[model samples]
Target chain A: MVDIISQGINLPLPLLMLLLGGLTSLMVGLLSERIGVAKLREVWMIIVSAATLTSIYYLNQSVQKAGVLVISIWGQLPPLGGCFEIDTLSIFMSGSIAVLGFLVALYSISYMEKESRLTEFYTLMTFMMAGMTGVVMAGDMFTLFVFWELMGLSSYVLVAFLKSKWGPIEAGFKYLVMSATAGAFLILSMAIIYGMTGTLNFAAIADNLRGAAVSPWIIALFSTLVVGFGVKSAIVPLHTWLPDAHPEAPSPISALLSGIVIETGLYALARVLFLTFDPGMFKLPIAFLAVLTMTLANVMALLQTDIKRLLAYSSIAQVGYMLIGLAAGTTYGFMALFLHIFNHSMMKGMAFLASGSIVHETGTRDISSLRGIGKMMPVTSLSLFIALLGLGGVPGTNGFISKYHLFSAAFGSGLGWLGIMGVLNSALSMAYYIRIMQVLLGSPKEGFKANEAPILMLTVTMAMAAIIVILGIWPAPLINFATSASQSLVEGLSTYIGAVLG
Target chain B: MVPLEPFLVSVGLMFVIGLYSLMVKRDMVRILIGVEILFNSANLCFIALSTQVPGFVDPYAHSIVMMAIVLDGTVIAVGLAMVMNVYKHYKTIDIRKLRRLKW
Candidate 1:
């Protein structure tokens, strides 16, 4: 079955499903319109995402057997043409994307029911997921760039989806200009890489350029690459657009954007950075960036009165935490990084979804106005409480477990100072989390009213909360999966290059 | 092989000009054009580098540039759409005026 598709570009099963699903969404929208069926686009979205998850399972099994599955394109293999090189790491990242996408699709059905242009919404959402899937699995730089832009374009439109609003329009334009500039940096980085190694395939580039002596050009390449991927990931100094874009976007998109999209950018940065230079070479700079991102975002989050905007700032803080693992640059550090990515997806995704439900019912994002609404929306508030606790790294939550590993990984790698700073920031972040909790559980203002979110939204948030707790207490399976995933990147370099060169 | 210095120098100059326009220009459309200029400089770098390959120009870089051009165009298109929306709301394309959302 895979052989037949080798005639063109060989995409992993899940990516192919998403891309095909995105393309057909418009036709399905028309068909549903003609048939006058309600929720047809919503149902299609759920099915496509569910199918994507299942395909990732199958692909994982094959990757376990094959070590690295390189599906060539147009009869041209890697080091020459674009292809997909699926290993455990790709499988893990794509799996996280699919899981969050499926959850968000379900949540969107209820959250966006009243919004017009359902067709375009679902189509763009699907393409966004497809683009992310393609990015993690891309064997070559050009393919990654293509998918990266697809993700960026879809997101820019989605951020401005509520076109009637001045807020979304202004924020979307700012995001577009900033991100488009980053795209140019990406192209420049590619040219630099191509100039250095005369190839863009990941395996080939790694083989040719890894551990080369540092030159002035290499430093230039490093800065360009950082600027390129940094904007999307919301690294400090490039993070101005994020606090706007995340809050302006629809809640489900906020969930996806904050949940996995930024992580996808970090994933690319980790992959390329690891492939190009030794961990020691990048350890100090990334560690410095980690400190800056965490400290600044947490401080800013403390001041946001808007609920979603606070969450957006908190997302940047979480990115800072994840960078500790990257700075550690060990296999263990990578494992912790991947684990945090998944856990944070569940935690942050649920937080946004729950907050979205609150906003949907209450029609306000101002925290002061939301006082004592927890009693009215008991289930959503409870789930959100769990999510907030997880984000704050409270015990018996997956966030705690991952944060423990992340900090310990920093310490273990002889970066005790980074670990200390991380611990302080974790404590600092809890201030805002507690503020939100107090608002939710505090006494209600006069005439304040909000019933619980609809059954679908409640169920999704509750299920995510349950996973957060379940994995927190018993995280062995996920830890093992993360270990293998990181190993595929950190320790599997020889096999990675061999798949192409041997 | 073609000389690499001249091409590199021009790429550097174009990059600085692009950044200058992006920073100094307040018009939304001009900012989009600035992004286009930045993209073109990178594409030209690829084309120039492709020429320096020993005996034949690498078609691979050319192919990547072709796709990159389309990608940038689509990005600019989206930016322009958003600019239209911005104009509708604020009745001005000056970026400084669109600063309602802030800390």
Candidate 2:
């Protein structure tokens, strides 16, 4: 029985932690009402998130092992069954997701204190975290899509958590429509790929693509995949739902949405383009999309007045920068891309949390209504200031480091025009961030109270703010990790082929 | 066996119609129906694709699509519920009335 169970399933430590977290959260949620364990729910969520992060941290230590740690539920091998695979890329992403998820859960404790559906919020958040972790660790396309829906569904519900508010309901409805359409595109693409390759495994598909003739059908498959993933990443022309969805969500959820959810989409796009398909075939289109996304998003962001909406557009712009790196299709490009993921997460996470604090104190998200709030909420204001500077790619922040690498990669890939546009957009983004800062710190408006944000919110904002600065100054460790992960992604194609075919 | 071409074409037509309605319709419930049409079209496409495989119907893909369909139904159901709430709060189903998002 042991041998049978161990046949094709190799469970890694990090995935085990995630699975444990998911199960524990579900169990607590189910028993919370009966056991009258209201306080225990929060404790359980924090413990699960922390344990998941700790396990992912340990997994990062051995990520250079260069192959997948697979685990089977039904004890069956690939091409015939499903399993989980923890690689360097997966572990790195899983670690970051765990970290952000833990922080967001921490932030949510105080954020949702007055809300009645606290248990539902924490329960849904746990499932969402589990889904994201699953997406990162999935070895097969089927597993990725399954977890993708899991995350998407939970997020849709969470977006409308305040059901009484028409804004959230409408926003959630629009989000569902867009997301469902994207899912259709994804499934159709997967069907086409399966039709051609006869397998749903990522490694298998890569192997098939390497030797197969490039037909129009394959091109169509690629196009569908791009559109599917592009919508999730909020790429141009498919980004209408984002500006509505982000601000409509609760602050902590918005932080998660902007910080990591969209990045996961970009990660999937990069994985498919670089890992499963030939990069040479998609280079020009990817570059075009990158340039267009960066330019359009910056322009839209400049026209926004609501603080969260502005940040939402800016998040789309950040995804554009990462796309530039991925489009370059070099090991260095992937490194820049991965590094920007971390940088963007920290910066945006801080920005959203700070915005949440302001909204909590001021009771509004209008940029114009927030005059002189910096003096009112010093800690929140300072955190927002740092995050704004970081977001604008100012010196002494993580954003500058990542954006610089991205520009360098763009130039190195001979897309110097793209690099120039990226710089222009970075500079353009500064106007909005600075404008918000000016309004917050400039002069007191009548009827505005001078009050500090809740301690929980302030702590979360300050923590992310410090990390942004620290990562900016001493980026060697992060640079090395991203570099190695990117190298593993670029170099693992051969190993991947061997693994899938064996 | 029945011909698959007409079924495939009908599915494609349904998808196009759904997109058309979703883009043009202002009523919330109408848009929901449009979403349902789009989802059903995708399911039809999947079922057709499953039939193309040689021997077995590719149980894995079929099952995944089945799950996706269920998810789609649930999502639309949630959307309709939200629309009901929107009507209660705003007293209208016209999306133009929900102009809170406009700059």
Candidate 3:
């Protein structure tokens, strides 16, 4: 048994994490087809949950033990051969993906019970998990592209999963067209990189571009990648698809889209910009984008009537706050970005889950119709209150702590205006957050009786809400993790070049 | 020997045109075709870039182009399925007509 275990398991930690989870989900997904489709919900639930959880464990352990793990296939040469370099930045990202994926999958068990075709839903979600893992861990641009498409394809299917509704189908179509076009821009940019540097591996291109003089093509490359990734992350001017798709999809998947998917896309943008290009030239554009994204999203969110759509806009604004940290381009900037990513995932995930409970009970997500919902279901409303407090950056919530770090990074890096604008955006966000709380706590409308959400959903929602406060009060551990992850990214590029070309 | 520069320019134009259509075309089918055009342009760019290495074609570029085509095909197929659904539900594919959701 020992010999078998040692010999058969030489795969690197992060890729192995994605593969085991992905392959297991694919296998279970296929099996569920021949078996009674809806008969084995528990089986699908156990398999996916275990897969995501186990992968999160191994990836976390490996990053803790070894700072960065690079795995290449078939002894092929790099800057060309497909490769995976799992560092702290990628670990932090993949960990966030898997952690939220596990929680959402847990919530899905109770939430998706009334819906049919449960097997396929879990399968596609797992494939999406695998796709995201592949993207962040990719060592070369092409690998990232390949996995990006995988994630895109899976998400389109998910967005349209409620195919019986015209709204879902329409939202899915718009999302597909926009996302696919963005993908083309990414490929074009990659071709430009290859045309100049003749390598797809990130480290080699960084070294090549670093030694070269500034050129017009390089600038175009930056803009195209930004546009390509910005759409997925729901940056302003390209965020029109989010409100429609998020509101139309099932709630757990809404959590997945809002909580993890958009951020992963932003991670690619930050990774490419931070590691592969001149950070100085890109800083201003990113800062401009940050300011634009926050202000516009806040304004739109203030006028929203639907619940999920409101959360979707709020998600875009959070990305803006993270982008401010990115524009600062310091280790502290990166720290702020990562810390806020973790915190927002908790707060927003809980927010969507709680609202989903409301929608589930009431069958309507319109803000006007849901007045006084808190009077009927205290637990769910309490969860929503906690979520709102976190989003509003109340003193004792995780959102405030992360936003504090982000503002400090902005000011410390001489972008005091950006930090101040960020504070203003947070203040603007308060108007809508308070509106939601008011509606939840208002007088109970006659003829509306909503039972409490299922135990499984309530537990998941409460768990995320509690984690927000706990992390806010004692934020040292998550902040330390974010600090270490950012430190690795700032310091790891040269070490990355040495390892790749050694 | 063929001039790759003109070919690259043409393909670049093709991509820009497709992007324009994707942005402005209200008809769903036209947008899907625009996506196809962009994919073909990207494929052309990949093939053109491979000409730099003399005497042998770059296998990696070939494989990537092939994979992109397949993914592109999947996207188009999905888009078509969506169009069919739209036609069934609303009897037309004009983008403006499906305005129930506030954009």
What is the model-wide C-alpha lDDT for candidate 2?
Answer: 0.82
lDDT of 3 by residue, A288-377 (tens): 999999999999999998988999999999999999989999999999999999889888888999999999999999998999999888
Across A1-502, the per-residue lDDT of candidate 2 in tens digits comes to 0111236445556556655666666678668867886767788889888988887877666554435455554577765676665567887787778889988988988888788877778878887887788888777888888888888888989888888777888888888878877887787787777767777788788877764567888788888899888888898878888999989899999999899999998888898777666666777788888888888888888888899999999998899899899878899999999999988888898899889878876778888888889888989999999999999999899999999999999999888988998899899889888899898778886767868978888888899999999998999999998887787688866665565456
lDDT tens readout by residue for model 1, A323-355: 999999999999999999999999999999999
Which is the winner by lDDT between candidate 2 and candidate 3? 3
Between the candidate structures 1 and 2, which one is better when assessed by lDDT? 1
Residue pairs with backbone overlap in model 1? none
Clashes of 3: 0
Rank order by DockQ, top first? 1, 3, 2
Each model's lDDT: 0.94, 0.82, 0.84
Number of the top lDDT candidate:
1
Predicted complexes: DockQ each? 0.90, 0.57, 0.74
